[model samples]
Target: MRLVTQQRALALTDRTSSRLASLQTLRSQIEHSGNLSPAAFKNQAEILLAFFPEIESIEWAPKIKSGSLDSFERRLQQTQAKTTQLTLSDSESSGIAFHLPIEYQHRHKHLPLQHPPGFDLIREAQWRDAIRSAIDRNMITSTRRYLAFAEDHPTDLIRLFLPVFQADTSQNQLRGLLSLELNVKRFIEQATQSNLAQAVPFEVYDNEDHNKIPLYHWPPAEIFSGLDSPLEHKTVVLPFADHEWTLVNVATPAFIQKYQNRLPIWLFVASLLCTIAVYVIVRITQSLAERLHEESNDRCWQLEQSNKALSNKMIEKGTFENALRESQDRLHDFIRISDDYFWELDTNHHFTYVSKQIVQFTGFPPTAMIGSSFLDMLHEEDSNSFRQALEKAIPKKRKIAIELRCKGHHNHWRWEKINVRPMFSTEGHCIGFRGISQDITDTKDELELLPETEPLLANESYGSAQQAINSVADQITSDRRFAQKLENFIHRHKATLDKTREAFFREALPEVAHELAALHEDAAEIGADKISELAGELKESHYKQAHREEQERLIEQLESHLEPMMDNINQSLHRQNPGSAGQKQA
Candidate 1:
């Protein structure tokens, strides 16, 4: 009997503890919705009903100001809900600063409560006090048992109050309140339905104030007399959200009678031992079967894990390959836009690959340059020297560099410098060479433009050299400026065509064409006939080619034509400084 009583007590404690913990969840539902309107409260109430069916009804009684009372009434009218029997009288509301009403309610089917839309709660002093306390304490508070008009008769009910406030409002400023109206008889019936509570009678009440009254009783019969005796029951205090409710559980008369009706205590102990022995024997047999089943499951689990690992590895490999391909594409794009071209040579020193940039640099397609020997493209005078350097460097797998002249598609010899490293296999056998080649003609011209002089400190020789170089640079800058002005003029007319196409052809085109014609005549007078010829081509193409295409074609031809004139000027500087040229040639 004592063991049975202990087991029931422990079970009741666990159930009560779980119920207390759920109070936070209940309070959170109210707090999370922010300011509750009818629709919002109804939605929350439906959620509570689904989660906790023991709840008879849920209510939201948000605080309303008397000043906003008319606005609040209009809002209620818009919802068109059923009205309550009484409205707040003007006299009653005069000093009432705030009015909390049942704005929303969701009632259970079995225990329905008709909470009309504007049922002001201020009339109920106990409810008013509980709400005020909850707001003051900034926590949940409960009212004593009260009679509710739910079933057309006075039904005993207790309400739990949780105050609401605007999230940004200070704690002392209460915005509204939420109330849960619990049917006392239904609540007790539900609590008593638990496995342990059915075997015992329990009563729950506030510990600090006996006058505050018990909230619920497990058995309806225990409501008045079952909690009267202290010697016959055990008590537990349920600490929940700033309030403590005392739980007193006592064995029922029927429970004690059933225990007494059992066989002698000694016989009961012997029977229990016999039953435990039989249970152990059955458990041994069950363990063997379970072991066999687990071994089969283990093999299947291993196969599944292996398959998943293989699938994951394949996914990782594919992702890595995709990333590598994207990086290669970006690298190729960089090479194409640059003034340099990448090249690769086989073991025989024959070109296996040349980048697309070769087209822009040498006026020769990359396809035409592939499979050609690197030595064949070099000027005859430098080929042997370059070949010797490669032969010495390849054997040691070292990087090599060489500057030589290559004939462009236009039959012009331009200087190019190649920087290369040998490619090797894992076994250390030389596979080929990979390198970048860049146009160095401009750099070579600048080097030739230097004055003929030996290295000197702050002396007259250094000053003279510096002045001479500056003079040549000024001439070069002047020539570049003229070329830039001509290009800008052509581009400006092309842009004008988009805005005034007919006017561009009639006025702008002829004016630019005549200017080029005059410039051509002036260039011939100056003995720069190459520049003269380029100007003549630009003037002639204005009538024969499309305006846009001709603009681009003329610009390219003019640039190419201007390069030779600049090169000639650089050569003239080199001739004036023979020692500088001689040093470069050596």
Candidate 2:
């Protein structure tokens, strides 16, 4: 708003000049041995922009004439080159443009000549500074004459520069001034030294007598009243201060006349374009929303399909697991009922399973047969036949049957009828086979107990009768020997009796004769033997008969002694008798 307002309060001295300023700055840099670009012209814009606005007018912008800028830049280079041709008339006392403080005493060169010799820029600047300051004082003094117009407003100040000639010397020097007076709404008091660094030259005017035309190198500010414009804008970007603003005020007469009838026509066109844009945007937005809805429906369908598939897979797996469990249970029950043990083996014939039925028949738990191979548990002689049975089964793919005894758990052998069959896969390749061993122990024992007939019976009878005859003959021979021994013993007894009788009579008569001799020799002594003598043989016949009776009694004692020995021999003989078969059996 400040810029819009300031446009009315400010006007351009010449858009032509400012545009030239920008072009000249760029062209100069390009001609020199330095890098260059558009932004380098910022200082040129700042310096040229002063003519467009006063400080308090609010709006400011450069009015640049592009065509004028190119023309003037080309003209300036040609004019400057021609002016500095070093003609014979040009002396060492040459005039140059500069924008620095001057050395007061030296007429030409500055005292502090810090720059390179080719450009004595300081000395040149000194002359320009002295001349501008002198003109500036005079211009301000003259501006007082226009004080009436700015009574209620602040003064606007600006500066510019150009060369002027004097009658006294062939060089440029001080001249009179041309000045303008204006008032502004406000002063941008916080602007810095650098902000106002561009050298805004003052205008040097001719004196009122018109004796000389002085160069107005510096510009003087001009102001206008009732500055309200139809549509103009301004901008201020001075350095070293926070942004501040002011809007310009002016009378409304010019605005009413310029825009009176044309406003509605433009407004109608703008409204039509806006309606079309809004309708197009809404159509595109609706299409995007429909596409999003379609995508969401597709996502939901995919999720539903995945969930159904997972559920079906779970049902299938559960059914398979249940069937497998039932099959296993039935197999175990079959083994239990048949009084048979079942086994499974790998291709290498290592036992993989030994059923519980094995424990019932073998008097052990299932573990007893587990890890036990078929041949390892069979009787040693049966292992070869067992292998032959497996070989037979493998080729024909038939049930291999064998009767072999397995070492029972009770330290005995059990007869088993093992039936092993070849098992093939659907491809008809053999992986392994199933087998069952039934306990046939009772059948074995019954066969053993059955009576022998034919060959067995005939050989046994013949052997028994031969043994009986040999035993009887040996007994008869022993009995005869015993009888002969009895006879010899009797004869030896009879001889011994006779010799004993003779010895007893001879010894008895002598003992009695000696005892009678002793009695006669003693004359009348009583002797025990003579007094105890058999009544003294009073009767000879009685004496003879008593002697005979005594002899018979002795013979009877001898016979009693012989009888027991004879009886013992007879008992031994009876024991050895040929008919005593019962005794021999005992």
Q: Against the true structure, whose TM-score is highest?
A: 1
Query: Taking the tens digit of each residue's C-alpha lDDT, what string does model 2 give over 476-513?
Result: 46666534544344333433434434433343423333
Q: What is the alpha-carbon lDDT of model 2 when measured against the actual structure?
A: 0.40
Q: Please, what is the whole-model Cα lDDT of each candidate in the order they appear? A: 0.59, 0.40
Off by over 4 Å in 2: 1-287, 346-350, 379-381, 389-405, 408-415, 421-433, 440-586
Which candidate achieves the best lDDT against the true structure? 1
- Give candidate 2's error at residue 250 in angstroms: 31
Clashing pairs in 1: none
lDDT of 1 by residue, 1-586 (tens): 3432333334334433443334444454445445446675566467556644556566555555556787766776676655222223232444322333444444534554345565556656766677667877877777776776655787776677776666555555555555666665665454334333134556667565567456666555546433466446776666544556666766556545765454255334534543443344335434533443464356557867998999999999999999999999999789868889899999888989999888866787889888988888788998898778877766545577788898776778889988998898988788888999889999999888878685434336325445545554555456756434433433333232132233232334555665567657756654557767877876676577556656555555665555544444445445455675445435
Local lDDT at 1 for model 1: 31
